[model samples]
Target: AQSPLALRQNILSTLGRTMLEEGVWTFPFTRWIKLIASELSAYRDAAPPDEQQSLRYLTPQDIHEEIKHSGLLRYGDTRTRVEFAHHTYQEFYAALALKNQVDDIEPYVDTPEARRRWQGVIVLLYGITTDRVKLYSQILGYSNDYARIWLAAQCLANAGEDIPTALSRLQEALVPSQQFALLFSVGLACRQLGRYPEALTYLLKAAEENPASAEVQFELGALYRQVDQFERAIFHLEEAIRLRSDFVDVYNQLGLTYYDQEKYEEALTVFRATTQLEPHNPYHYYNVGTVQKILRDYEGARESFRMALKLKPDYIEAKTQLDMLEKALSTGVVQMLEKIPMLSKMTLEQSVLLANRIQVKEYQPGQIVFHMGEMGDTFYIIEVGEVEVLAPEMGRSSGGVINRLGPGNFFGEIALLRAVPRTATIRATKPTRLLAISRDDFSAVLSRYPAIAHRLAETSSLRLLRDRQIGRRVDLDRYYDPGYIAELTRQDRVTVLMGDIHGSTYLTNAIGPELMVAFLDEYLLRMSSIIVQAGGAMDKSLGDSVMGVFGSNPDVPGDESLPVKAALLAALRMREEYVILRDKWKQQSPEFAHSGMGIGISTGKVRTGTVGAEATMVGPAVNMASKLSKLAIKGRTESEVYIDGVTRQLAGDSFATEPLDPAYTKKKVGVELEAYRLIRQK
Candidate 1:
């Protein structure tokens, strides 16, 4: 039996053939009936005389009856025009018609109007067209529109057909600027076709071009998963999630990867997280239930499965799981409590007893669970969602968040251990659920299980020791929100570009402080604008220099070398703009004309975070960039732009560079640094 989708496709394909034969796309219902009748008559006439006599030819009335019954076509409000039930159906049939009649589709795609009208047809054709290489080559030849070209590439990638010839053609025609998109598309195509080695080669190249692309990271992670490279898969998936936190699909894929490795606990955590991200998604709930069932949390599994069913009443898989869970419970199967750090030492009986006394509590976002200085005796373990630990005394009006806790994390342990006031305020950062145990219940379990008490005491003592150590250091929460601080604190590969006005002091003396300040402001403003436009963040502006960092924003999708490229481009633009500015300033004052801007760029890993209440980037690259900027001083070097070896390497063939004399750089910079003179972009 054909599925509904297949049946619809068949019917649409037939209608498309009829439309093509009659050379009409849209028409009145009466005209459509005539076309169908004419097509049926032609088919009967082509048959042998004996067969024609016995053949069942659909008349105009028969065709009209079938069309009405199929519900695949509908009349316009005026009852004059007839069209496909859905636009997609119209596009699907049109593509089939074009594939049947046209040998070369480039002519149709070359014009904007044709491309727009038949855009869906072209994409659909890529999937079913014979000689996809020829088709791709034809489209590539005429289409200069990147979006249109990319659309074709995406179609070819998802065609699920072997495309070695098409891939080779695309590679040969690859434009330097479009390299990332082309490589990524080809890699995706190869991956879909199960050509893992080819897919990896292209995707790796694409990644080098733009490491910040969450899509590329996701594809790489999925590819790694297919190749059974669990660790690599996890790394890429985690990076994808980090690059785009709201990527619910990546979370699900990451969860599935963990499930493949039989790491049920990790899988459960990831799957549960997806539920928080997309609360109404039945699939996420089903995934969570599956992992819970494996981890022997029957009750949790039952709840998850029930939720899935509630979201999608016809979710058969969820219904089956819920039924099975109920049967297991009826048979007296033990549903163990989740293994938390504090409860790890408790025996099954003791854990179950303690679990029964544990009360589940919910909190809305921004709702305080406990206030600082309030006497508290309840310990909390986050069941689902996040909470912020705030310290008002550490000083922000909103209360400084000292730490953030998520699922499986516990706090308020000090209150459980002794009669003390809450050291910090606990507030829900999102819709949160926590498992709470009163001191009496916890103490009862601890009294019955000596080992549990000892283990918890050791853990609590370590936490206290860490807290005391943290107290001695500067309170980071006082300067920035803990969440912002955590986000800012990371080690990452980045490109740092430093630009400084040469002979600024001389200009200051010649122009005077009044004119110098005004000229400097305009100069800095223009330079800063150029840097930002090139996708670099202004780190800071010191006395006569402006510093910018590229690839600092994880949210900005680009290749690995993108930061280098952007930094280099900004440097070139700055020089060009400064030349124009210098010419303009020369008309006003000779002092400003003589002062040239020198730019230095370096690419390497850096530690970025809040320092002394301000965001700062600290690494060898930062130092190298500063030193190189000095080397590029107008009278010191042949060029106004200098870059270190790492930056040059990342810049690749996209930019032109000449190696600086090593001995000369060493003598001037007081370091044995390999440097290059930025010539120009190739």
Candidate 2:
């Protein structure tokens, strides 16, 4: 929330203290900030006693005087409620206090009220240590205790520490027993990230520090079970149970560990004990039912599953299990409507009732279930037999069969979740029975069940991000920077030209980032040079998109049509320049070579000058031109420039163009404007 200016000043002012580095200024500013104002002697960063008296905020009048004079801060004229100039300054103070391990920082981190109020500031504190892990270790590792220690320890654990060398040095110097919380946090971080061996070592060290901590023991036990050390897992789990009898998580893991070791009776005992500990939890019954079902105790499993459903009516997993049990009454083979991971979180009783709406269909061998490019909403679970997954491959005659899934394996969520065309074909490989749920039913469930919808969104988001990161997808990017200089001349006929690079993600991923950035830098430079030559000003840069303004630059004449002419010339030359770039990169970085961009140009009369805080652009031209830039890119590989009728007419036969479909621009832009695609320069 703090302005960049205020943030810089806060750092400068604090660091400006000559002796603060001697430990005068608290690293994590806490309740001590107020105390420091009252008694500066103890709080001086490192100032000698003689000079400490010169510190600010010595009296009420002095505090009031500085607050009014600085002009950087604005607040109610109350001493207790006065705030810093910017939110960033306050956040910086908080981080500094924590780094110094100030005693009073616990309220900032521990108290819910303070934490929520300062959540924005507190969240950014982690970023401080991101690139300065060494500095963090050297300063907080040795000097700080409690709040700072465990927090910093957890920070190191979350990162993908490809370089364990730094960790080794930090670990060797620290005594885990001396700082129980710090050691425990490090162990938990590693365990969550699947660094099981590293987690085990840290947990063991932490356990040695405090054998009485059931939390530490539980973590150690669970981790041991994960890595297949059943006996050791049971030892620590039992220790945790001895320390805290009501540790439901401990019982759950103990039961699972016993189950993994094929000690069925012992596993059942532990699971039952967990149910006794937390009778209301549906998951406990579900766990018991799962074990019973696997052990061929169908009757017991049915009872447990029924109890789970009774406790939580919307429990999809439990409901699925229960439904399967009912289906198994005749054949003894489990059946499901669909296996959507997030569906269990949804509270759609109506959708659950609609589960009966699912059709059971049989497909003979070689019958196509669904084909690629066909949009579908239905999800299918294999009730019996097998289905072959055929996905498009570059070198295959028949689309390659990627998978042959049998009973229990389900398909169709990808299309249903995204509402997109099927990416692969599904066909029956044998006499296959499928339990199907329609798209309408799925959508109804998602709309009514927010928790399930959120869970599904998380999955889709991760997948989309993964696809974008690897260059297989190009996501539309939009951004606006705050703090604009309001400058607009009302009569200025500005011609705006916008260019967006298409398929950038693919090229960026194909070539390494280093080369791709270099290519973009050179490419943008070439386009920018053309604009500068035409006396146009680059107004904004939105990732692959560029915004340029004409007719307003001091270097250019005040002719209203001058900008439009310059923009057109620049746009035409960009296409020619891109051809050269394409060929060069094709030879130099062949794999990354891809087709170029699209342009939208429009000329309209508008206000363009030094603007105020509420500054804004108002004109039909600005929106039209921006929209056209997006339109020009539609379904085309090679570069193309589309201009509004005004731009084409203003040029007066200087360029060759023909009117495009009026309805296309009208439908897209929501304004009836004569649009033309610029073919070439006359």
Candidate 3:
């Protein structure tokens, strides 16, 4: 066809052009030479004589050796060999040209040697690069027998080429069953690149195609763990373990999974087995100690912690545990020594048996030792630390403080009873140390010295009650329990008085409202001060009305005789303050002199809390107080204070009481309830 002469001229021209453009021929490597030669030979072998004449000069043996030297075929694994060949020749070359920045082909792109051997591989296959246009053009020039061509596409996929291109090539090649592995590989690549939501879809498809794949299960488990789907992680990890039990890392992961769920016992068992399986792992021993401490197996915890410390003495977690144990032991020693602080007179061995059971602890600055009102289950003997104690008032509180606790001064002895909360809040002022004593150890101490427990309990209870009263909420339990509230009936007579300033609306409107608010604020504050001074609790304050408790928490220990005294003191204080405030206000406005208070005081039992529409109404105590206050307003009695008969008796003989005639009282439930007016003996 006159092509030998023209072909030689064409080859020379193309080589010159390539060398000028790249400083070397674009495909100058030995592999590239081999690939080009092999592909020519392959075409010759497949063609009949007339077709073969197109490139009949090549030999088959030469092509086979070219394929072998490229390292793609050295393993003889068809998938790997084919994958290497396709990428080295097709996808790689196309990527280099597309990027437009190749300076040194030797490092930047595949060697020409690789290209020579795999050039034929590229011609046979298609679609292994993002540049589909290039691949399609390259495939059109190659021999079109479908099997050789499809094999080439698969080879590119194995070499980590562009996945979308690989998929397109595989689809065109029409070999779905054979391409399942490639699809799975693509899915893993997608996952590593942080395309999880997309990767999941591909992985599921790949798995459906090849359900028995172990690699797939491993990948799925990892993904599930990433998303915190522990249940699914357990399921997949279990399957993986069943398939391969010697997977030590997986066992560690399984143990961590259990730990995260707070299934400590199960976690313990798992970690123990793992440690046995890998004896040198200190982390496993540390985990084992952690679980033991959670179980309250102190001896076992101590032993495990010691093992961890022995393996890794510098471990902070292990050291912390050792500190906790020592503190516990020290507490035991203090309780023991309290009974026999004089034991310094005894022999060392005698003390050793007792001291061996003790534990000591240390706390760092800013650490909360205990919260106020928290159950004190253990006590401490300050071995080498200082702690601060604070008074409990809502915000502004002032009380005594404990600055330093040394070896002899012990605290928290009152916690033996289940009911006691901590008397004061303790916090480390500096790096402090303590000897801790458990209730159990103290009980043992008490068995040996019976009076010590009784003496400690009595002293502690007195201190605790004083602290509670220093600043605390009312303890309703002292006055009445649930049974008392439940048994209380409407017929039970307990009177209460609630009162407010009369003509408050008219006074507010005339006094420019702003001044009225200030007046009411001062009034209520003085009233509340008096009530509290009188040994009564301020119940609740509406905008004007004041509700108070004369005997709510009666059992709160100490000052039991002071409630009536406090109430009377409050009334006197309120009267005194009102005189001054009223005179000042009268100068500012006429409304101050005109405005007066409705005062009512009664003593009778009443049901409390919400009652009517929307359950908002309070019970008869409030209702009777309101009725009595209205009566005081109508009586033209200045600073009117009224008490029923029961209050007269509670107030005792120092006061005088006169029953108001029935005609002076209003009817309620078709009967006139008797009332009284009271005053001090003149």
- Cα-based TM-score, every candidate: 0.36, 0.33, 0.37
Q: RMSD (Cα, Å) of candidate 3?
A: 18.7
Per-residue CA lDDT of model 1 for 190-251, tens digit only, reads 77667899999988988888888887888889899999999999999999999999999899
**Candidate 3 deviant stretches above 4 angstroms:** 1-161, 166-183, 210-215, 238-248, 258-266, 276-283, 286-602, 606-682
Cα lDDT, all candidates: 0.71, 0.63, 0.53
- Model 2 vs. true fold: TM: 0.33
* 549-638: candidate 2 lDDT, tens digit per residue: 666554455655666788898888777766766675665466645656778898876554333543334466767777887774346356
- Work out how many backbone clashes candidate 3 has: 41
TM-score, cand. 3 vs. native: 0.37
What TM-score number comes out for model 1? 0.36
lDDT (C-alpha) at residue 505 in model 1? 81
lDDT of 3 by residue, 455-557 (tens): 6555544444343322222221122233433333233443344656666777767765335543554465456545544545555455666655454343455
User: For model 1, what is the C-alpha lDDT against the true structure?
Assistant: 0.71
Lowest lDDT block of 10, candidate 3? 471-480
Q: Which candidate number has the best lDDT?
A: 1
